[model samples]
Target chain A: MLTSAAKTALYGAHVSLGAKMSPFGGFLMPIVYTSILDEHKAVRTAAGLFDLSHMGQLVARGPAVAEWLDRLTVNRVAGMREGQARYNIFTNERGGAHDDAILYRFPEDWLIVVNAANTAKMWELLQASKPAQVALENRTPQSALIAIQGPRAAEILAPLCGADLDGLRSYHALRTRLADGAGGVEVEIARTGYTGEDGFEIFLPAGAAPAVWERLLVAGTTHGLRPAGLGARDVLRLEAGMPLYGHELDEDITPLQAGLGWAVRWEKSDFIGKTALAAQKAADDYDRIVGVVMDGKAPARAGYAVHADGRRVGEVRSGSIAPALGGRNIATALVAKAASAPGTRLTIEIRGTEHPATVVPLPFYKRPA
Target chain B: MSQPADRFYTKEHEWVKIEGQTATVGITDYAQSSLGDIVYVELPAPGAALERGKPLGVVESVKAVSDIYAPLPGTVAEVNAAVEDDPALVNRDPFGEGWLIKVSLTGDASPDGLLDAAAYAEFVRSL
Candidate 1:
């Protein structure tokens, strides 16, 4: 029990053995000052602050910025508006997903926040694979990221950052100040989040993050912002039916096969893998991605087999208990063409047992109005 | 709290109580807390051989799937069926109704390979 020291120590009271807890992302973090379920429920109802400093950010600059990026990514980055952000995929020439990124364009350079797990590999790929003219630098060491997300997120962040965030619209970003400083590093706050809840990803120097974290926690306590960890982050994204990169989209799978074809700018005249993408589109034989809602008590997990007529049809790529949509099991699976349609009945193998399931439209959950 | 002083513990985080040759086994409090909420537990059959340190059954929580290792080698076991239905039994009564199975001790229920409450407490502390 984490509460072990509190009841035992008399002066451990003053010097309570604050837990050195290690958890998600290979870091020991606090599970809760309270409980896991309580922290999970808070984000569903109100707002929560998460230390997402582990996520990686890369800056791309130099002469072939537009031309090289447009070629390297599946999405259209060349036509991106200033201060706007877009979710795009970096892929191999074979069209497999190398990384899923949020591309941010500023006046000086373009920044892409990538999943932390892919940081090293993505850097190596960019150095070896991206055009010779594009200069890609890993800026993760210098910055930290924070997510203040949920229904009241905008309201909480608005007064502190002092930017017209309401008018900023979704997927927009701007350079904003915390305490009015001109001689030092600046913070760039973006309206981006891994959680489906509306939120902002505030970027600042790594050394200055703890102060901001403390301030936000103090400022947010009045607004019911609990300090949530990666556990709640997993549940939130699962409920929102968002796909995690390693789980849903991987190096072996193409974005088109993962139901992200709409993001590929085929209308653009040229891009990397354009010839292969065109051929795949012409073939149209890809086994597409779809959502599966389980019909039994079991939670489907990664590598669990998806079944059709007692035969293994596919495997669950990512699965979890959907917190927002009650306690039912939800999964994203890559099933065959016929079974990929909504309303198609399927089965999920949990452990050794097969439970009835069905193909549903993407996103088993959506934000309430 | 540290491991209860009166209880004996297996290295795999299982705690046991033996009366005669029949021994009761359940996950330690530290195990349940680490596994988060216990969502499902697979209990062994009434007459199956289980070797010490070998997996006797499976326990799936919201966070991870764990192999419930045999506390002591034995044969033919009675299971706690309640956990199969309401798996939270491990969280609620980890030492009582939360017991996974009763095993008939095989070799020595010897003290050498096991940990006392003080040692288990120290071991968990090091973790």
Candidate 2:
């Protein structure tokens, strides 16, 4: 069964129109909006607006909130100033990544947005980790996030929010009142996006989101904004060299091997999985993530085996023939050093047929002008 | 968008433009619309023998990979190279510049089995 939460990753999910429905992140999300290629192009050449309301939102406060958060997360939270956000990780004691989150620091507290499927578990962990003075609350039902992304996204969204958008930069957010009597809503416009374009993610009240979206659609028509689904979002993020949670990193993949070591605060006084990560970093038998380009027409979608010569070398983590890259089969995979070099020759078994493949640098497509 | 009257189509949406023993091949407008923004096509090599209704090639869209079927039996005499370079041509010109392959027909190339423009339009509407 596809729930509302399953719909975020690939927008257009759970539409009553009988499109192929797949359960993703606890919601039913669309793999294609009309068609994957068209949607992808809309984002690449024009602009794409995605409904990312299904991501988890949590509020933690009190004296122990900060301290408890520091003990639980991989990234150091002590340095976060008000109105700032930082990417952090939830890790197991063995150093494997459980999930990733964005920590938004408020003047007196913090809002941690996490993956939909991981929300309950993360909340439970916080419940156990919170000190006597701390309080944790899950606010997923109250918030809806909409992303307006592409080269011309800013120009399209400026009038609606009436913020100083010209000076707005990436990773920065501004909270402001939305339309009058607009369902008791307040919107936080973040100059952040998943499509690797200049765009914004607007966070508003769940009830108010639809109205704001409608207004944006009317306002964004001149800029060619499309209501893109999750399918296009994946291709765009992959093209930009960003990683997906389940595809690139999971409970089995550590932050170090996933090329997310930069997010780990090694110098922090103490944090979960720090010792294990330190030990893993000292040794090397595990694989690291990198891009792969397969030859010929057949693309190696997820769950395909990577082969060196005729033997299994590794597994394809994420795979797609990107639209912007002119239909070349590209992927990210973790493999042993013998098979992980940039120029290493390999093959991917697609439907029992072996397609010629090669290891390439991360990101198959650069930002198009 | 066109559905040339004299051509036959497969359930997979391939169109065969027949002329005596020679039949030009391309995907239908419906197929093009369904596939959307063709990025790369793996066409069967020239002179490769293909059976009717069999997998002849593959098409990669931005989001998914789809297989192409041979609409009629014959050998591939020519494959569109322009599309290999610029797959968007398939979306822009599905009938002319977007044509995929040319095959030499062995025997039957049915005109009765194919839909006229009106019929194809109805087929699309029904879909």
Candidate 3:
């Protein structure tokens, strides 16, 4: 089965570690090394390493690179300073999301990290809308991304990194050297993560990934760093109130409906989906995403019907057992505005039985300051 | 982990330990491992009738929900409350403290369709 899927440079390493390999985003990726619960706890309490090579990395360079991207995405890309990373979303003409992405501004070029599943689509979109001046390149196949996430991330990475780890702020990036055995490997380190933790994501050549991964593992062993997988990553993102591409923000779901209006720059002169998004904002009656906590042991699941006052209102987009919330079942549902208020009683229909759930605020878990 | 030699297994990865007219049922270790972390378990109440190869309850992990099937025809005599309270027991001790249900075998009940320990191990390997 793995033969049909693309393998990362760490494929052999993951196999040797007895990781459960599964297909994700067109790649044969590790789903878990030991158990999801153990890995999730490791990321929360200590630190966890992740193979993010499957994500897409697109590089664009030109004088009008940021300006052209500003017209295509829903955020202010042109105003971004060098070494800054901003979360942005590409939307369709109808205000539907094409993909949620992070744009990292460099001195000479911009690196856009997109969802792996949307890599092909995003590349086509960029090329079709590209002007004569902007040059676009897909670096995903040649690049590998590794992320060390959690409270001990900086402590584990400071010794190996040449850049000032303590000085790096969140959503900032720097091109630096990672200490290898004899020489240094040039890499880009970004202090951004989907897990809502203090972390750093390293982007480097694919050939350099395995060695870096092993080096980090060796250095992090005493710090309780474990190799987490996609299963744990999914749980962590959900607990952090982050959105997954297919679940929370798809082609039919807009940034406004997903509670990401802040990512949408309405003040921008002109962008795709501006008109429709403006109308949706004016109406303010669109069905929106809300956080839910089930009152029973049965966990809510994606596509489960959500009902309020005996009427079908929405369906769950993503659901999982939230370890941060003490093993309680949590979910995100796209429901009508009337049912989106916090403390609103809602019911999730599971296997023809209605289970009690309450509408709470987004972000089921928050890191202590 | 090795399957208990005294039990009969099903193709769906369920194990049944039969003694006299009573049978204890639980999922195999492979099933629990494949399901990852177990967070919830729903079972039938005592006195519910179950047929062979029929859905009995659900076992939910953080990522997925799997249906647990009955191994033989029986009347549910008791349910394991420990698992419903702490579902991780199914992942920790799947055969012992994680036993899902105990059933009184029906009059026509038979283990004809079930496989023994060796056969079940081979079946798992074939997968």
Candidate 4:
């Protein structure tokens, strides 16, 4: 077995705190600090700190960056203003999603944040698709990302940040300094998160990550902040109706099938997979993504068969016992349009037995406004 | 992670305590801790037969789903209803309240190759 894996700057701190470490995204990461339930609840009620350094960050700069990005990703990049971010996908000509990413626009460069496992593939794809005027650099090794997410995120993070976070809306980024106990560090703070809550995703120099992480935990201690892990992160994101790369999305799935049609811009002149995506949308030929709620606590896990009228109609893409939603079993699946209605009945085949489930709306849980 | 000195353990992390022909079974603390918070458990009925070292039931944790194996060939005398209703007991008290099933041994000879407490601790450490 391959024992040695990549470690983040905060690895030592996680070990000291007795975090259960596991392999994820080619790195040995904290799966949980205390328990999955407690960490998950902390994110919903108060605030939770997360180590997201395993995500891939790539920088594209120079004269033709805009045109290069337009051809590279599915979302519209030409109209994105400086300090703005757009969720996008990199796909093949067949309209299959290769990877999903968040594109951040700076004045002189574009930072594309991708899933960690797809980093090398995305880099090679961009290189092959880019024009000579564009310069590509993988800055993941030099950068670190930490997220402080929840209802109390703003109040907990306000004191240490130099930037005015009150006006920073979702998907907006600003470069500023964060005051830490050791020393202040430059960071790009973005008001965005996968947990469906108000939060900030801070990108800072890799060397200063450990200090900044410790300071954030201390600052948010009074606000009920806990060090969360990937286990909790998974349940939170699933409850929010966000799709994971390998689970809800893969090389064979398209953006439209995953209920992410809004990310694609049909008005764009040309881009990779645009032709196929336009065809798919025009014909409305793809299966629709719908939420499934089990009758009780029985969880419908990924790859479980979804049956309608005693016949297999679809398969679960992601499912979990949603903690924020009263620990109910909720799932998302790509099903036929006929069975995708809000009140349609279905059955989830788990351990060779079928359990009754109901087709609900897209997201199982939405944070109160 | 506590393991009682009297019980015998298997490489699969199950513990068995025998008294006469009946044997009580449950997973070890190391097993429950490694699996994280268990959400659901599915066990065989009281009258079902179990083969030694074969799958007996399924335990679904918040992290993943793992199969529980039978340590000795026996007939299940009783299944724990408490654990079926609230699976978190497996994490809270693995030895006492979280015991999965009580089985009546079928054959004369006990299941061989079971590890003692010390050996089980060493096996968990290697993991």
Winning candidate number (TM-score): 3
Instruction: Give one digit per residue, the lDDT tens place, for model 4 in A171-203.
Output: 999889998676698889998899988899999
Task: Report residue A10 deviation for candidate 4 (angstroms).
Answer: 1.4
> TM-score of the candidate numbered 1?
0.86
Which order, best to worst by lDDT?
A: 3, 4, 2, 1
Question: Which sequence of candidate numbers ranks them by TM-score, best first?
Answer: 3, 4, 1, 2
Task: Report the lDDT of model 3 for residue A306.
Answer: 100
Native contact fraction, candidates in order: 0.07, 0.60, 0.93, 0.67
Candidate with best DockQ? 3
Better of 2 and 3 by lDDT: 3
Interface RMSD of each: 1.8, 3.2, 0.7, 1.0
Query: What is the Å distance of residue A33 in model 1 from its true position?
Result: 7.3
Q: Model 4, DockQ value?
A: 0.73
The residue pairs in collision within model 2 are A5-A27, A6-A26, A6-A27, A6-A28, A7-A27, A10-A230, A11-A230, A13-A30
Per-prediction DockQ, in order?
A: 0.30, 0.36, 0.91, 0.73
Scored against the true structure, residue A77 in model 2 reaches a CA lDDT of 86
lDDT of each: 0.76, 0.77, 0.94, 0.89
Clashing pairs for model 1 are: A21-A28, A21-A29, A22-A28
lDDT of 3 by residue, A22-114 (tens): 889989999999999999999999999999999999999989998899998898998999999999999999999999999999999999999
Better of 2 and 4 by lDDT: 4
lDDT score, candidate 4, position A122: 91
lDDT of 2 by residue, B50-122 (tens): 8877899887776567888887789999999999888879988887899999998875655556666677767
Clashing pairs in 3: none
lDDT of 4: 0.89
User: How good is the docking of model 1, by CAPRI class?
Assistant: acceptable
